[model samples]
Target: MVSRAHPHGDDDIRLLGDDSFEQSDEKDNLISFDDTSGLRHRGPSSSHKKPLSAARSVSPSSAQDSPKGPVVAVFVVVFDAKQGNRIEWSHTVDGSVDIGGVEYKALPSGAHTVSSDSLTFKIGSYYGVAYFRTETDKSSARGAVFRSCGLLGRRLEDIVGFRTVLQSELSQGKHSTGDYHVLEDLVGGRSDFVDNAFTPVMERVNKSEIELMHDNKIVRDFCTLLGADIFRLWKCVLLRKRILILGTPPFADLCHIAHLCSLIGNYDISSPLRPDYNLLLYVDLNDIDKLRQSKTFVACTSELIYQLKNDCYDVLIMKNQLHIQDPALQRTCLTSAMEKENFSELMHDYNLRSSIMHVDSGRFDATEFVGGYFTALNEKILSAFHAADCTAEQTIADSALEDLSLNPASDVPFLQALANMHCPSIRVQRQPLCPQCHLC
Candidate 1:
């Protein structure tokens, strides 16, 4: 017969041994019943059959006696973008369960079911589940099954959109080739028959050959325009086409020349061209004192100027008091010089104002320094326009032209008008202009 002992004040009951069944402990409260034959006894009647083992006993602790439920194993999948694949699933549990022949312990007791899609687990008794999605599956297919379960609305789509946009923007533009019709006209003294003179000699020059030829032409023109003798030396150094400048030595001016070459080459006038030619500058000299305070300063500048000339660059040297006669050419050089300084504070504060004032005051021809500075400024202006964004190019060109216009002695107001209509500007300058056309 099954015997149960009740806790004095608790709902739980303890099962006692057959000997203890006859006497109730003060801590236990026992109730005895008669056998089915109807014979009464102090304990369970001997005639009554014992309860089946599974149901015979009750423990004082309900936790020990209650039937434990099945545990559900949950797998949470995570998509890994860097690896371009789906990573392994993370497992959780509603209760303990065996997975892949290994026992997982201490899961919350509940009815459990493995996910047919293999990426989820449902704890039926607890009404809980876990799920995840993979990156590849999310990208290629709209959605895929995970252990027979639908995996939808499980991943982020914004990242894909951003990447697509970025790639499209990066691959949209073409390379630059320096080609400017106006500059060619100015240099050759007439626009009537110059196109044929600059036409490609070969039907299709390879990219490298085109670059080399363009670089050589840029150096030659720059030196000649500056009235320097560097172009002759450049012809001699055909074997060493590349030139490296060790000090600052006005890099912005060279970049301007490069931009002019691009214009002449008919590069996309609307976009900034990536630099293709190599011109390395080393600014990190180990000796700080050797920079501007040494006797080597003047020597270094002279040597650099000589080398630049030898390399076929138009290297014009000016005493602080030199001047020039042609107003148009002077204006162009002034713009180029401004560009060479990369629009630095020094250019804006001193060179640009001084050049403009000299040209306006009709004092440019009085000093070689004024003439040289003007030439450099013109080159710098052209390069800046080339580097500006599509929308800002026209605006910047107009502003530059206006600056030139303020100087009555300057002679390129018509060209400035054309620039204002067609050129692009730096992207940052795309905000709407004021009624006065001022960039607000």
Candidate 2:
């Protein structure tokens, strides 16, 4: 229900890009969703021209038929080639209109925004973005013209970040070594490298908590932790799950250790730990912040409890004792690590399990839950979560679950942290299903 301010005339202005004028029978760039990230891309038959009917009008605020409440009307004034400017398809982003090969945006004179696959450049006071100018100023950079777009948009930082990521992607397999593209030679070189450098060092590793994928008969179920810098991953991997560093910085997705430690200072655990982290690399224990909570980190080879029931350390390295500090409850960072699919499945399980446990009467969402399956599930995660809970820490008996569970994201955290998780740079961990062990 569009309650336009003026219903009589075609006051609803419809602006078109320069391409609209160039091709009489063609349409403008149509944005469609890409499957990988649900990002928008320009389609071949793109033409967006919704003529505002003279009889129809939209409410200024909160139209009854609108599923999302509160709508604002923005006037779009398209800039064409006459102004020495044109909107072109951006390579770095899909469905975005930029000036040159990924330059500043040239939004309609009064439009609120023009967006791309993952960003929204919009107009705002003192720091608005999404504008363009015909002239360029040379003072900003070398041989570059300052085609003034509004400032303070996400594009300011996103452009640099996106470029860095894109450059890395494009530079893959760039043949910097000049291998001369010969399969026989490549295979021979690889064989030589393996014989001389790799095969000689292949020895039976000790205290193995993990086995090769081909060696293991059972399908390894995994949970994903992403690069979102959430605290839940810090605890689940470093503390409870004892995730092996299969990858590392400059090598692969580095663990979010910097963000983890800085969030709550160095870690102090009430439980003892003896980490059995056999490695090609050596990590300074002084740089390690969290202790493995499951007795010891000796890959569970021996059940002897961890020494130093309470130890504080700024970091962790081999053969290093923890620098004693006052015992403090580890921080959980109070961030959820939930993904939608896992959450939904877990909810079904939780509901069913709760019914059996006789705690299904008061159901749970991500926001808040008290004394039921949620509490049990929360405990399973909190114990595994190594980071200190930034908010109130809970005990299994009386601890509470406070999260943005009302949002769809709440579901995955329970699944990932409790279930041993999905997403990129995922961690595969052992699940505690043995009834003899304490409840997970």
Candidate 3:
């Protein structure tokens, strides 16, 4: 049997040995286990729109517009004076579904260590958005109660609006005119609830609240930061390199960067040829064992000490510098410099387009623009080998590699591996050789 004191081991939240660990009345009484019949899926509304065209075309799973109003549950995680970190309150649309083990992920790993910040993290199938706040309250157990609002849902882009609403509700006082009274209408599946409560947020959701889908600025920043090294980074991720991103307190940026890295070189979201990136949003020393088990994964750490754990990671990204453990994978500064120059020209065109589009109602979505570059490159490699007869395929791949500033010696083999794996998906048919002679 596992010890209730440290069910998840020493790395868990500071709540392991607290007196309230064994007996917490609020935890038990707050959520009554009613049958699934009480739950009602709200009718579909125009308010929750679908993802961008490219995302929809890429995979149907990427676009999630559920009838359940985008959010399944809204909960609060507070740094308890006695219990360390605990879920103060939570309400789910499905009364029968229990929120278990998620309390550990609701709040970031080192949230209380900082004053205030926000982050979006993955917990199993559901994504969690948390905004931690620091307030001054003398009557409370401590001078200030560090409480965070966590929104859990399947639609990350759509439910982002709830973060602001929950923050407002928390500020207005969560005890008397608190969450239950404000959110009680949601349980009844009121048609007007989402429109009324999140009107202002709804208006801006498509434009700016896009997290995983398109957020143009994230792609811009990521591309600008990596420049030509982006190709090297893409290749590393495609080959399943162990990458660790280290940064300061607010890990939102780090987490986003990690996700971006995972997306790079992934031609198809649903491609079974390569598995989805094993992403560990926030990890610490306590998670060393878990890290060891993962063959290839992208993880973020706020602690600098992880840099010393050299054996765990093949690539270390810190302070805009990428340190590769393998000598053969060292940064090709010359090629990177040339790529940077080319990228600058590309950005000039993009900026001009952005300025002109700003005056028009139509906006430039950069998600496809950035992601397409890699897809096109991958297509070039695949087409080179599969579009022609097998005899000239080597020559074609080598020529394409040279054009992309890739090392033919190394990259040709990589492209060959991808071709072997994704030949059917990449290029459905190859040019067949002539029947009479071996050569076409």
Q: How does each model score on TM-score?
A: 0.17, 0.18, 0.66
Query: Which candidate comes out best when scored by lDDT?
Result: 3
Expressed as tens digits, the lDDT of each residue in 229-317 for candidate 2 is 22333333333333222111111001112111121111222223322221111121211233333222211100011223233222221
| Candidate 1 Cα errors over 4 Å, as ranges | 1-270, 274-278, 282-311, 317-331, 334-400, 403-440
Task: In angstroms, give how far residue 265 of model 3 lies from its true place.
Answer: 3.0
How does model 1 score by TM-score? 0.17
| lDDT of candidate 1 over 68-102, digit per residue (tens) | 21112222222222221121322222223322211
User: Candidates ranked by TM-score, best first?
Assistant: 3, 2, 1
lDDT of each: 0.24, 0.23, 0.54
Q: Clash number for every model?
A: 60, 38, 0
Worst 10 residues of 2 by lDDT: 215-224
Count backbone overlaps in model 2.
38
Clashing pairs in 3: none
